[model samples]
Target: MFIDVLKNIVITIVTVLIFISAVEIMVPSNKMKKYVNFVLGLILISVILSPIVKFLSNGDKEIVNSIKSYEEIFTDNQNKFKSDNVSTLKNNGKEDTKKELFIRNFNKNCEDLLKNKFKEMTFKSELECDVDFNNITFNIKKLRIGIADSKVNKIKKVRINKEKTDNKEENEEYSEVVNYISNQLDIPKEKIEIYKLEE
Candidate 1:
């Protein structure tokens, strides 16, 4: 590129110089010669500088194209980075929500189990409890039981620990139910509450 531009510049300079010399020799009047020389000088200057102007114009396009390509690459990279970050955030949010939901459902299932057991033993009751989960495993947090009375006094259950003898079967009552729950849930009696309902 430099060589071609240099050659063009040299050729233009030589041609303009020769034309100026010829015009200076051919012109007659001194005043006319001065005017003609001034014009020729201007023309010579334009011709000599034409190669540089052409080079600059051509170089401007190449420079602009390279800068444009670089800008496009940078924009593409920025967009990809942003997209990846958003995807990670969404996945993390989903995981946390899923974990919370799992714990909630497990607690509900525990409450239902207790309700079923109470029903089977003919004990009309309502219960609530909090469940503990660590690393996706279930444990107990707290428990409460409610018993309603029908125009009578309400009796609360007492927690007991005893092994049944093979010779005798036991009748189901408040104490038995409390013991059953305490054993089944592997929770202390302090964590289990019994509410007595008034008629």
Candidate 2:
């Protein structure tokens, strides 16, 4: 935790200094001041970038570590899922067939409705979906909107519209939809908005 905090502080300070130096370079200034600032900027940048260079040069150590952790989890889950699927396939063949049919139909309808809906907006850079099975609610999170960094004009937009439905079939339908959006948009799960709905 301490290391994480230190890393964040270092990144923040380096980012600020880089931005300041960039501005100093762009704006016209005295020759002496400009040269001095440029030299100092180079030194500061070297100091700031050294750790990052070392970190990256270690052959992506952190990324490999994260991948290994994910691999372990996925392997465990795959084994459990395979066993459960085998048992389910044996015990409830009819139910499994019915569920598949419903899922297919539901997905077709959703595709027809959501096609080309998100392309009209400019400020809304990305879209995400969230579903809560326990509470039977579906939610969406739109990024680059209502945030100062994104410069979105909230007043121009009326409101965010969401669809709600009730029933196990509808929940299954939403599950397919949310999963589709998550994959297609390349958005992270943490960035997705989650809400509770009837179904």
Candidate 3:
């Protein structure tokens, strides 16, 4: 019985060696070849140790159970990683939406305030702001005001030996508008710009 068992083991090993050689010849020489070789090495080791392991444990079910448990752990970890990435993306989208809403509301409020203060003139406003997401702070960088339409008439004054400039009244109006915006919005005068829109 011992001699027969030895012969069977020798035949099994020689068959496995021949199969491994055939597989190696068929596999391409590339990055994937190393991975294939590693898997085949593991199979070879397991086959060589099968008899000793069966003698000690008396069954193959324990090995299969251990492999199944490892697979379960790997799948659980992969699922957790994917969920974490999805949640991070959602949070980033929410933050971007919040910033857009804040900017839109701020511009609307400024335009409304100017409209109420200067009843005779129509104003359009644009604002540049620096936003800090970490601290949730907004810093006003610059404000641009465009005079879309004006109903105020230019006052003409008679002067002795004075050359009249066509844009003098418009310049004065721009200065006044700039000063008003600077004071009301608590922005620096230099940081505010006022321009008349072309008709």
Candidate 4:
């Protein structure tokens, strides 16, 4: 609607200017020529301004609609962005939980496998172990050297032999056990430690 009014105004101004130019060429008196030119200038300005005034009518509605559309688009995009962030956070939390569970299960399995292997050994000894987070420290916290035979009597003889234990035999036995553990578990020898149980 506004464009049609603007185009008509431009055509009118052009037509009027051409007519004035043709009249000015034919006018005889100089004073009449000046007055005619002044009237034509005023007529041209009014023609141009008339369309501008019409363009301002009902313009507030269009402006309001434009602003509202932009705001709606912005709000939609903001909501979408928030939802994407929430999903990513949820996925990250789930991934972390999965990794923690896997690590915990792996540690438990290692403990069970090592315990069963210890029980299968020839000596009747009891040992408890702990492995580090990086699997670099395998420590034997408790090691009971000998097991008592089952009997009905409650009373027992306590023998304290300070000098009778053969160091060579004990070292060989300890070395054999350590080598077997290291080989079976495929863990480094430096990471393993043996300790006697506290009475």
- Top candidate when judged by lDDT against the true structure: 3
CA lDDT of every candidate = 0.62, 0.53, 0.77, 0.60
Clashes of each: 0, 1, 0, 0
**TM-score (C-alpha, index-matched) for candidate 4:** 0.42
lDDT of 2 by residue, 16-121 (tens): 6787778777867677777777776787777777667867797377668767978999999999999999988876776556555544554454344334443332
How many backbone overlaps does candidate 2 show?
A: 1
Candidate 3 at 40: error in angstroms?
Answer: 34
Question: lDDT for model 4, on a 0 to 1 scale?
Answer: 0.60
TM-score of 1: 0.39
Segments of candidate 4 deviating more than 4 angstroms:
1-55, 120-199
Q: Residue 138 lDDT in model 2?
A: 45
Candidate 2 residue pairs in backbone clash = 137-197
* Candidate 1 lDDT, 16-123, residue by residue in tens: 798888888889977788889889988987886776687587878766777787889999999999999999999878777766676566557655666676663222
- Give the worst 10-residue stretch by lDDT in candidate 3: 162-171
The per-residue C-alpha lDDT of model 1 at residue 165 equals 27
**Which is the leading candidate under TM-score?**
3
- Measured over all alpha carbons after superposition, the RMSD of each candidate to the real structure, in angstroms, is 14.7, 29.8, 15.4, 12.6
Task: Summarize candidate 4's per-residue lDDT along 1-199 as a digit string, tens digits.
Answer: 4455467877888898898789878887878888988887888788777756755785677667767878899999999999999999998787667656655664465545545656543333344555454456556544333312232335434557723544333434466555665686575655444332222
Candidate 3, overall lDDT? 0.77
Tens-digit lDDT track for model 3 on 26-137? 9999999999999999989988998777646853565566668788999999999999999999988888787777778877887898888878778778888877788978
